[model samples]
Target: MFKTIKNDLPASIVVFFVALPLCLGIALASGAPLFSGLIAGIIGGIVVGSLSGSKIGVSGPAAGLAAIVLTAIGTLGGYQNFLVAVVLGGIIQLLFGVLRAGVIGYYFPSSVIKGMLTGIGIIIILKQIPHFFGYDANPEGDFAFFQVDGENTFSDLFKTLKYITPGSALIGIMGLGILILWEKVLTKKAKIFKLIQGPLVAVVVGIIFYAITKSNDTLAIAQSHLVTVPIPEDTSSFFAQFSFPNFSVITKPEIWIVAFTIALVASLETLLCVEATDKLDPHKNVTPTNRELLAQGTGNILSGLIGGLPITQVIVRSSANIQSGGVSKMSAIIHGFFLLISVIVIPKLLNMIPLSVLAAILLVVGYKLAKPKLFKQMYDLGWKQSVPFTVTVLGIVFIDLLYGIGLGLGVGIIVILLKSYQNSHFLHIEDKSNGKHKIKMSFAEEVTFFNKGAILKELDSLPRDTYLELNLMNTRYLDNDVIEILEDFAVKAKERHIDIKLVSKRGVVENPESFIEFFRTRPKSNLSLS
Candidate 1:
């Protein structure tokens, strides 16, 4: 792991810059104390990264959990009380890992998973646009369709025209230009260019712009448009910011309900992020989901104890890490250390880093995730893969993360059923022999009841005077309902002047006594069609 320090160090700097404002923003959106977000960021990085099996994945206070935290804080009476729920939520996640519930993440369709990453990319772009132009009404981490700032995602874009800050927007455009130059040109020119990433450069330029333009009203970035980490004057004041959970509220039933909700949602988000990050990883490393849950649970427990929000594996940060060339978990660990040390040391300097620069950084991340080529690639794969992918993207862009996934999963299942119905068998027709229509129908590898409708239709549509062959040579598992259907069809064949033959690895049996018995006694084999 240490061997990749050159890569991990630079990646960590980029992730650190990406995570700082987000930690504060999510905490702001959650209505928690600003410092709490930093605490979660720190714990998520150090504790979770150290324990996690994932190399490129990063954990932090997630935007997905912001609303949950906001509601729980109010419903549970106060911030201190809410901490109890977070702690309990961590416990519940630990239990989930022990129960091996992490396997649930594997059940998602590939189309849906792709849709998720693309959808999140689009959301990131949309969410950052306002911030990019220095319209700082919404928190940087807000990813939902509807905003806490009384604007929907698109509406926010339109609103940006009315409040764009010239100074911030100028710097944002400059930052974007620098990122493009570094990524598209400079990095290929020299090894040193790779070490000093574009995001770090953009942030430094943003700080310099803020510093030098302080006297210029039109070009000077406003304080509201800059990073706002809580600045402590001394060590004691910094330590005082950490809040301890009010454990007395642990006995409340409402607290437990809140805890369970947090655990379930956070685990789901983490699992989905794990899937997305692993796909993005250049190394194609697999993360142990159960272990990830354990790491997140441990992180959350520590975060809550210190008055921080619930933690999850955040796709934005993880993807940024992967995109920035993170090779190991050390990148995540170092970013946490940065969060820990920076707030205690150079928070005043951090405050000078304009939000627009960070917004520009995120915009690049977003563009990569939702690249135009991906759309064509999915479309080229055909509707079976594309439809759910499209629906998931639309749902996520129009609704929210979990809702989008559910909608995509539902569409994916429908696609499966449709394909199942259509693929029940391959039918072939031959010239009439002995004044009878001859047909051969080969069953699929696995025939389930979902295919009953198609098979029944094919059998029912046969000519009155016909000879039909039921080919089981390549069929593996035949459903009882389907076998029963064939049994019924065989009975009706006598009246229609249709003769039926059962063909299997056991050999052909003309007018089998019982379709069900014949199939039950037959052996499945890799028999090629003749």
Candidate 2:
């Protein structure tokens, strides 16, 4: 970890800048205290990082849980009650780790995962637009179809256009331009810009701009565009920010429901991040899924206990970690430590950073995740991959993240089934021997119920008086449905004066008496020939 630190410190700084605003934004979206998000970020980085087996993955407060947290708070009666659910959710995730359910992440198709990332990228860009324009009526990270204010996503964007504040918009544009310039040109120039990070520079410029405009009341940006950190007047007031759960409510069924909701969503998000971070890792390190779950579980438990939002291994933070040159877990740990120190020691200075400047930084991060090249690459993979990928992307953009992924996974499974059905069997015809046409039907490996229709159709199409050879030597498993169809075809073959040969591990039979009974003689595996 120390060796990794020397090489990754620069990247860590960049990740720190990238993570700071997102932590606050997610907290705001969850309707929890702003510091709660920072707390999660710190714990996710420091605590989870130390426990995680992943070399490159970074953990943080995720946007995906914002809606769940918001509703859970209300449903559970208060934020403290929601903390109980989060802690329980963490315990549930730990159980998942112990049960080795982490392999579930590997089963998802690559197309669907890509779609998820793209979808999330688009959502980030969309959600940040309002912040860029200084119309922050909704919280900084809300991305649901319907918002707490009763307006839908598109409606909020349209509403923002009509009420754009000049100072905020101008500063936002300037910040974005500076970010772009830094990435495209300044960062490449070692003499002048190597020592300074673009996001840090953009933030400093925004603060200066805000201070300059403050004197001219007409040109001033509203408080909405500025970063809002709760300023406690004294040590006692700061400590009072921590909330405790009413454990008496734990008996209520609603608490269990909320706990399950958090567990499910948090687990899914963590799994997805594990897969994504594996992809992003320069060394192509495979993170142990179960270990990741355990790490996340521990982080969430700590976060909940400390009045923080639930923690997940977030792709956004992980991607930033990778891009920032993080090679080991130390960078993640340091970033978390940075979050803790920033809030405790210099929160006022943190609040001086403009929301628009942060939006600019995220815009860059979003583009990296959903680059046009990714779309082109997926398109080249053909419709089987591209269709699901596009569907997931659009679903995430128009709907929600989980919905989009579910839709994509459904489509991907259908495509797999279709391909399997297409390749399940092959027919060959040879010259007639002794005045009968020789028909050969070769079955594929592992024939399941999905191939029943196609196999039956092929058998039914054979001509009368044909000499048929039904091969099951290559087939490992024949589902009961296909076995039944084969048995029915055998009776029809005899009636049609067709000669049928059944080939299996056992000697060939002229005409099987009973398909199920013949196969019963042998050990019952996936495949049995009567």
Candidate 3:
């Protein structure tokens, strides 16, 4: 791992800059103390990164969990009680790992997974736009369609347009320009450029801009637009910020509900991130999902015990880590250390960095995730892949992340069913010497309602005086809908002078009362078409 330092160190620096604002923003969005977000980031990086099996994935306070955390805090009567649930949630996740439930992540269709990453990319860009313009009403981590403040995502954007801050907007534009120059120009320079990253350079320039603006009242930016790290007056005051959980609420039903909710959502988010990060990795490293769940579970427990919000393998941070050239887990671990040391040692220096600078860093990340090439690539894969991918992108953009994913998954499943129905059976027609046509129809291994359409089409297309032989010898399960369609076709066959013969493992039946019931009476056997 240490051998990756050359790449990991620079990547870690980039991830650190990207993570700073997010840590504070997630805490703010959760309505928890601002320091709590930093705590989660620190723990997510250090504890989780050290334990995680993922090579290039980064963990942190997730925007996906903001709503759950907010509600849990209020329902639990205090943030401390919610912290207890977080810890318990982590324990549950750890148990899930031990139980080997992490394989569940593998079951999601590829289209849905791609949709998720693209959707998250769009959301990150949209969420960061306000920060880019210095509109701080909504917290940096609010990604839901409906914000806790009662403003929907679009309404919030309109609000930002109405209340843009000049200082924030200017700084943001300058930061974006600096980043663009560093990437498009300075990066080509061998010596100095390779030594520093664009995000780091942008941050330094933003700090200087902030310092210059701070000296003049007329050009001053409000404190809200600046990075707000909690400044403890002294060591004692700093230590006072950490809140311990109220374990007395451990037995309450509400605590368990919150615990289960966190465990389920965090695990799901982590699995999704693991899938997304694996795809993002240039080396194509396949992360061990079960191990990742165990690692996340342990990390969440630690985070909650130490007064941090729930942690997950966050896609935004992970994508940023990958884009910044992180090759190993060391980059993630080091960024966590950066979060820890920055808060304890030089929070004032951290505060000097502007939010606009960080927004510029995320802008690059957002672009990389939702690049035009990705869209074109998916489109080229055909409608089966493209439709779901498009729906997912739009759903996430116009709705919420989870809802968008669900929509994409629904579309993907429908596509699969359509394909299955079309391919369920094969029909071959032959003209017999006896002045009749022999039609052979073969059924698939498992026929469901989805296969009914093609089956009906084939049945209805049969010509008069045709001798049809329906084969179900390989079929294991036939759905009720398909059976009904067959029954209706059998009845209509007599009128059309169609002679029907049924063949199965049991034997051949000249005429059957019920297609499904006839099969039910047959001896059980392994049925496979192939």
Candidate 4:
């Protein structure tokens, strides 16, 4: 882990900057104690980071769960009650890991995955625009289309025009300029620039700008437009931030329902991040998905016990880690330590960093993710890939993260079925074999119920008094549904005076007695018949 400190250390700093406001913002949005977000972020970075197999993915309190957390907090009676649900959710996630439900991430289409990344990128840009211009009515981490602020994503843009702060906007613009110059020019000029990182420099400069202009009225940044780390005065006050879950509430059926909801949503989000971040990793490391759920489960459990929001593998932080040149999980762990140390040592100092400056940093991150080239790239892949990709993007922008993915996934399934229906079988005809029309139909490697219609259509259209060769030599999986279709066709073939010959890797059969009976001797998935 220490081997890549040169790369990981600077990368961790960038992730720390990216994570700070997000923690506070998501906490505020969730209607939980602001400190709870920090606790979750710290645990996510430290505990989940240590346990997870992912080298690049970062975990934290997610904006995606803000609505659920808010509602559960009210419905479950109180914040303390919600903590019980969080703990139970962690346990449920652990079971999901044990059951290997992490494989669900793998089944998502590549188009949908790419769309997710691009969609998130677009959202970051849209969500941060108001913050960048010094209009921060909505919390920084609220990624949903309809916000707790009672405004939608686009409405906030107009609101920004009404309430823009001059000083905050100035620093934000400068910060963005510095980031662009550092990344595009300064980093190439010297080693020190890369070591310091652009986002860290932008944040420091924003703080300095905030400090110097404090006395100026028109140019002064407002308290609302700055990072708001809880400033605990004494040691006891600092420790007082932690809250324990009320285990007595665990008996409530409502608690169990909330727990299951958190478990399912958090686990799904984590698995998606695992897949997305792996795609972003320059090293191309494959994260062990099941282990990730276990890590997340453990992190959530610990976080809930110590007064924290539920945790998930967060793509924004993970992508920031990767883009900042993180080489291993050490970066994530180091960032967690940074959060822990900052909240303890310099909460006031952190509070001085203008939110707009962080918005600038995120703007760049967002641009990198939603670059114009990806749209055309997806489009070039054709509608089969592009349709779901487009749908996912639109859904994310107009709806929310999970809903967008669900919509895209639904479209993706339809595309798959269409492909399956078309590619189920191949046909060839040998002219006049023994004065009969001789035709050969070869099934695809894996024929399922989706192919039932196509296979039946082909068989029904076959001329009477014909010789049919049913080839399964290359097939590996034949669904029971398709087998039944073939069996019924075989019985009808005798009356049509069509000679049926079945050929497979096992052996040839002429007028087979029962296709079902034949495959019954094989394994459940019919692997042995292949």
Candidate 5:
């Protein structure tokens, strides 16, 4: 891992810059102490990063958990009480890893997963737009369609337009320009540009801009529009920033309920992000899913003990790590150390970094996730893939992350069912000879009761005085209901003056004794038409 430090170091800096504001934002959104978010970020990077099998994935305090954290904190009576739940959640996630529950992430459809990434991308761009213009009414890291402040996503954007801060907007525009230039030109033109990333430069520029504009009354950005890390006056106060869990709360049944919820949700989000990150990884390395859960469980346990919010492998940070050329988990570990050291050493300097600059950075990340090319690519894959993809995107943009995923999964399942229905079998009619139509119907690889209606309709529509061929060559599993249909159809075919020929691996039979009897008598391999 140390061998990759050359690559990991620069990538870590980019992730550090990206993770800083998010750590603070998600904490603010969760109604937890801001320092708690940094704690989670640190543990996620150092502890979880060490244990996880993923080379490119980054773990941190997830925005996805902000709502749950917010509600759980209130419902459990206090932040200290909620800390108990976080610890318990970690224990449960460990159990999940031992049980190999990581496989659940594999069941999510590709369309839904892509939709999720795209949806989040769009959300980041939309939510950050307000911050980009210095409108900070809604706290950072609140990505829900309906914000806790009672304003919806779109309404807030409209409101931001009315209260745009000139200083913030100017800094944001300049920061974005620098980022774009760094990616498109500077990185290619010089080695130095590759060493110091665009986001870091953008941050430095933002700090200078804040200092310059402080005296301009009309153009000055408010402190609310800057990165806010809790600054302890001294070492004693800094040590006090860490809070212990109220272990007494563990006795409460409600605390366990909250723990289970966090475990279930955080595990799900982690698994999904792991999947997305692996796909984005240029190495195409597959991370051990069960191991990831164990790592996350441990991270959350540590995070909770130190008064941190819940932790998960976040897609945004993971994607940033990959895009910035992170080659190994060292990047994540380094980023964690950055979070640990920076908060203590440069809290005041960090506070001077404009929120708009970070917003500009996220805007780039968002654009990459929701690229126009991706939309076109999904659409080209056809409705089966596109519809669910579109629904997932819309649901995420208009609803919260999990709900949007549920909606997309529902649509994806419907598509699968519809495809199953339509693809039950294929029917072909040969040219008529001597007033007798020759029809061959082939069953699919797996025929179930869901294919019953379509198969029955085709059988019933056979014309009189025809030779009907029932082909089961490709079928691997034939449902009993479908056998019953063919058996019943055999009897009806005689009445219609249709001669039936049964084709199977055994041999072609002319008017087989009974469809069910023939199948029962033959070996499983012989029962399939060849």
Candidate 6:
């Protein structure tokens, strides 16, 4: 891991900057003490990062969990009591790892997964626009359509325009321009630019802007518009920030319910992010999913014990790490150290940076995730792949993360069933002479109950005076449901004046005694179509 320190260190700094506001913002959204988010960030980085198989994925307090945490905290009595659930949740996740439940992550369709990444990217961009323009009405990191502040995502954007702060807009726009220039020009022109990223430069410039405009009334940025890390007046006050879980609530049934909920949700989110991170990894490394669950479980246990929110592998930080060129787990571990040291050694200096600058940085991240070309690409794949992808994107954009994924998966399953119905069997009309028709039907290699409807429809459509040949020449497995349909169709063939020829490995049978009796009397080895 240390071999890539040079690459990881720079990327870690960028992740550190990106993670700071998110930690605080998620905590704010969760209705928990702001410091709890920072603690989870610290543990998610140092503890989980060290143990996780993922080289580039970063774990932390997730925005996805904010709603759950908020409700759990309220129902469980208080934040301290809620910590008990977090700890138990970690234990359950560890058990899930032991049970090899991580395989469930692979069951999600690729279309839905891609949709999630794109949807999240779009959400980040839309949510950050308000912060970028200097309107801080919504707390930073609240990406849901319906925000906790009684305002929706689009409505807040309109509201931001009415009360924009000129200073914030100036710094944010300049910060974005600098980042773009640094990436496109400076990196190629000078070694110094490559060594130091644009985000770090943007932050330094933002701090300077804050200081320069301190005395100006109209151009000055408010304290609320800047990063807000809780500052401790002394060492004791710093230690006081950490809280211990209320162990007395361990036996409560409600506590167990919340624990299971967190375990399930956090594990699922972590596994999804793991897949996303692996896909985004430049080396295409596959992380061991079960180990990741174990690592996250351990991180959550320690975090809850010390009064931190539940932890999950978050895509935003992981994507930023990958985009910033993180090459190893060292990036994630080092970023955690940066978070710890920043709050302890330079809390005041950290507080001087503007939230709008961070928003600008995330805007770039968001654009990369939801590039317009991707929409065109998905559309060209045909509706079988495109419909679920489109639904997943819209679901995440308008509803929330989990619901959108569910909707997309639902659509994807329907597409599969439709295709199955269309591909079940092949039918041909061989002869239509005088007033008689000869029809031949061939079953697919493998036919299931889903093929029942199409076969039944064809049988029901047969004309009178037709000669029907039921062919199982290629069938290897015929489901009982389809077998029943064939048996019932044979009985009805006599009434329609249709002469039936049953063909299989058992040889031809003319007007078989009974479909079920013929099958029951046939030898097992001769049952399959040759």
Best by lDDT: 4
Instruction: Write candidate 5's Cα lDDT for 1-530 as tens digits.
Output: 99999889999998998899899889999999999999999999999999999999999999889999999999999999999999999999999999999999998999999999999999999999999999998877898999898999999999998999999999999999999999999999999998888888999999998898899998788999998899999999999999999998698999999999999999999999998888889999999999999999999999999899999999999988998889999999999999999998998998999999999998998888889899999999999999999999999999889988999999998988888989999989977898899888888888888989888888888889998887877777787788778888877877899898877776677774665577666556634433
Error of 1 at 209 (Å): 1.1
Once fitted onto the true fold, the runs of candidate 3 whose alpha carbons sit more than 4 angstroms away are: 432-435, 460-464, 471-497, 500-525, 528-530
In order of appearance, the predictions have TM-scores of 0.95, 0.94, 0.91, 0.94, 0.96, 0.95
lDDT of each: 0.92, 0.83, 0.86, 0.93, 0.91, 0.91
Relative to the unseen true structure, what is the C-alpha lDDT of residue 92 in candidate 1, on a scale of 0 to 100? Answer: 96
lDDT at 324, model 4 = 94
Clashing pairs in 3: none
- Encode model 3's per-residue lDDT on 1-530: one tens digit a residue: 99988888889999999888888888989989888898899888988899998988999999888988888888789999999999999999999999998898887788888888888787778888888888888888888878888887778778889878787788889888888888788878775776678788788888888888887766577888888999999989999999889999899999998899999989988987898889888999999999999999999988899899999998888988887778999999999999899998999999888787788788878887888898989989999999999998888888777788789889988899889978899998866847779999998889987888899988998889889999888887777677778878878988998888888876677764554456555444532222
Candidate 6: misplaced stretches above 4 Å?
433-436, 471-474, 502-510, 521-530
Residue-pair clashes, model 2: 3
Q: What are the C-alpha RMSDs, in order, of all predicted structures? A: 2.6, 2.2, 3.0, 2.3, 2.0, 2.3
Question: Tens digit of lDDT per residue, candidate 4, span 248-343?
Answer: 988999999999999999999999989989998888899999999999999999999999999999999999999999999999999999999999
- Give the count of colliding residue pairs in each prediction: 0, 3, 0, 0, 3, 0
For 1-530, candidate 6 gives per-residue lDDT tens digits of: 89998789989999999999999999999999999999999999999999999999999999989999999999999999999999999999999999999988898888888999999999999999999989988776577889898889899889988989999999999999999999989999998887799999999999999999978998899998999999999999999999999999899999999999999999999998888788889999999999999999999999999989999999999999999889999999999999999999999999999999999999999998999999999999999989999999999999999899889999998998899898888889998887889889888888888988998998899889988888887887777778778778778888888888888876787774655576666446634435
| lDDT over C-alpha atoms for residue 95 of model 5 | 99
Alpha-carbon runs more than 4 Å astray in model 4 = 432-436, 494-497, 506-530
The model with the greater lDDT, 1 or 6, is: 1
TM-score, model 1 to reference: 0.95
Candidate 2 residue-wise lDDT, 392-460, digit = tens: 998888878888889999999999999889889899897788878898888887888889778888888
- Of the two candidates 1 and 6, the one with more favorable TM-score, higher being better, is 1
How well does candidate 3 score on lDDT at residue 283?
98
- Residue 521, candidate 1: Cα error in Å is 6.5
